[model samples]
Target: MSLLKKFATVASGTLMSRIFGFTREMLMAAFLGTGPVADAFNTAFRFPNTFRRLFAEGAFNAAFVPLFAKEIEQNGMDGAKRFSEEVFGVLFTILLGLTIAMELSMPFLVSTVIAPGFTSDPVKFENTVNLAMIMFPYLACMSLAAMMGGMLNSLHKYFAAAIAPVFLNFILIGALLLAWAQNYDPLQIGYALSWGVMAAGVVQLAIVWFAVRRAGIKIGFRRPKLTPNVRRLLVLALPAAITGGITQINLLINTNIASGSAGAVSSLVYADRFYQLPLGVVGIAVATVLLPELSRALRGGHMQEAGNLQNRSVEFTLFLTLPAAAALLVFSEPLVRLLFERGQFGPESTLIVSQILAVYGLGLPAFVLIKAFIPGFFAREDTRTPMIFAGISVVVNVTLALILFPRLGPTGIATAEITAGWVNAILLLSVLIWRKHWDYDAGLIRRIPRLIIAAAIMAAALYFSAQYFETYLSRQAGLLVQATTLGLLVIGSMIVYFATVFAIGGASLSALKGNMRRRKKAAATPENTDISA
Candidate 1:
């Protein structure tokens, strides 16, 4: 497939997932609100999610996909299939054991690792522990699901893997609605959401498993064997694991600090959900499609193609992310109030969450750029470079958090996160340029100024629109008015951004139209056999 079509496939699936995720978070905010129950649930959810990203999304995929793609390139499909089984066997055993141990030690983890913010409050601390224990095993299911996702991506079947997360949100939303229907306590709704997380993992695993099988790869449990391929995968995975873990360590820090403040963890979580919608849609979709393509291109010694792919990925990410960042900055309050002001979530909670959302907005483009840039390194099987950069980002985040958190509270943590993201992105781009590993073409360079101009125009429009809407939205209005106003702002911002991009020649309508035509032709071409340099 052409890069554009491949990106489209991934982006479409991601869009669906993001929509459902937004729905799920909206229900969660209404049902549980930003209070003790929400705090406990957020803390509990972060535990497994943090590790899941570290292992499944970051370490495992960064290592697994390129190796798997190379195996398919070097030794044919059968050889790659066998290698996947061996790796899956070992991964399954290790993740299962880790999950059990984590679940068993939930109390100590909560007290020492997760809920330091609630140190003085025994009730919140205990609830976080209990909820975390119930949710801990979600890591295993998600880890396995990620493995299956890697395999499917290698086969160029991106839809199933990308859409699998939508199932997760669907199940969680259903669980929350069920709790509401039963008239259960809000805390009970939180518990249901936790269990729903595990259940969603199961459903996601099943979806990917079926997709793998449909692609003619059957995965099953086998006696764990340390095949050469499996050994190599483990070796490659180490740096990625360390890198992903370090990159996410700020979350751990934030959680630790949030423990001391009532509802801080939950407020961060709500804001994070908003940030993640765009990140997951654009950043992750691009990363997912880019890695395998870059890996294949590099292996085939197609340097120019690899460079072009990286450049386009960056452009596409910026195209979507810039407006998203602006929307968050201008509409954070209305967005938060619209989705979360009903039920138990009150105006005070909306204000706090919006503050964090705006702070996170400052970092959105950087975060998306990181997702695009890091794969350029990973595709060359150079995990160490990204690891070094991630380590630097960690230090920056920790230093900033330590300096600011005492005086600024949860917003300080948000500031620290955005600053770290900028540091990482700048370092990544600089290193890539200095090392001559990636470069943009004349077209890409010429269009950047236009893109910036377009973004400026959109930002102005959104700012004025948001200011105008705030007065009407600030009243004791119903959810419909808030939702409607926020929706209009988002729609207006997007329209203005895209129209300006086209008008200013940042991205012409004809150019994009031509891209679609080319994509169809590229997809019709057969796979090449000579993938080796």
Candidate 2:
């Protein structure tokens, strides 16, 4: 598939998932607000989620997909299948034990490890523990799902894995509505959301399993053994886990500090959700599609092709992520208000969440760049270097959060996160250059200034459009009007940004247009011909 087509396949599904995720969060805010109930729920959810990112997104996929892709390239389908089964067996055993232990020690884990937010209130603390126990098993389910997703991604089947997240968001939305209809207590609703998470995990696992079968890859449990391939996977995955762990520790530190501040944790969660929409859509989509492809190119010694792919991935990521960052900075308030300002969510909550979103927006590009760049290292099986940079970034994040949280509250935490992201991105690039692993070609160098110019135009256009449209988005306005005004601001900004880019020679309209045409043509071609070349 063409790069653009692969990107579209991943981006389209991710965009849908993000939209549903937004809807789910909106319903959650309406029902729970940023009150103690919201606090407990967000806290409980983050516990399993932090680990989910560590194991599922961070450790497993980072180490697994590239290795799996290599096995397929070197040994054939059966070799790859055996590798997957061995890893799956080991993962199942480990996750089962971890889940049981975590569930049994739920109270202590909630009060100490996860949410120090509950320390001030006994009832809130207990509710958080209860919800966490109910949710901890989700970690196991999602871990397996992520493993399945890694397999699908290695097989170049991006759509199913990308769409799996939408099911999760939809399940949560359903649970929220059901809770509302039943007039469940706020804490009860939180538990229902927890159950929804588990359900989503099951759905995602099923989807990917079916996709794998269709791809003619049969995966099954086998006798657990530390075979050579499994041992190699463990060795590589350990550093990834540590790297992921360091990053999670930074978040946990912020969470701990936010815990000390009333409602700060929930505010950060809401703000993060807004930023994650773009991060998920652009950053994650690129990482998901690029990693396996990069792995194959590198293992096959196709350095030039790998470099070209890397450059294109960076260009594409900037094309999408820059506009998203601009929009978030421009319309943080309206976006927050339109989506979350109802029921228990009040004006104060909106202001706080919007502030956090703006702060996160400032670092959105850096975050996306990290996603695009890290695959360069991971595909080459170089986890230790990224781990070192991650450690440094964590220190930056933790220290800044500690120094700023006392002064600016949750917004300070958000600012610290952005700063840390930039720090990490710079460090990664510096090391890559130092090692001569990655260097921008003349074309990439030429494109940088043009991209920056385009991004600046986008920022200016979005800012003014948002200012102009705010009056039409009054607090008492109907939801339709509020949504329409928000849409107009976004659409107008996009038109202005594109027009400015085309006028100023900051972007190539014809090149992009032609790329799309090529992708459509390629997609229409026979599958055998598509792969043979």
The TM-scores of all predictions, comma-separated, are: 0.95, 0.95
| Model 1 vs. true fold: TM | 0.95
Q: Which 10 successive residues of model 2 have the least lDDT summed?
A: 524-533
| Residues 204-262, model 2: lDDT tens digits | 88888888889888888987889998888888887776664544566777887798877
Q: Would you list the clashing residue pairs of candidate 1?
A: 117-259, 117-260, 118-259
Task: Estimate every model's Cα lDDT from 0 to 1.
Answer: 0.82, 0.82
RMSD (Cα, Å) of candidate 2?
Answer: 3.4
Q: After the best TM-score superposition of candidate 1, give how far the Cα of residue 467 lies from its true spot, in angstroms.
A: 2.4
**TM-score of model 2 (CA atoms):** 0.95
Cand. 2 Cα-lDDT: 0.82
Q: 1-533, model 1: which lDDT tens digit per residue? A: 56666778888998898888889888888877877888888888898988988888888779999999998998898888888889888998899889888988888888888887675778777888888888888889899889889888888899999999999888988998899899989778878888888888888988999999999988767789998888888877878876656546778778887677777888888888899888888888888998888888888887867887888788778777887887788778888887778877888988888999999988999998998998888888889988888888988998998788888888999999899999999998999999999876776677777777888788899888877777657646665776677778778888999888887777656545545554433222112110101
Total colliding residue pairs, candidate 1: 3
Colliding residue pairs in candidate 2: none
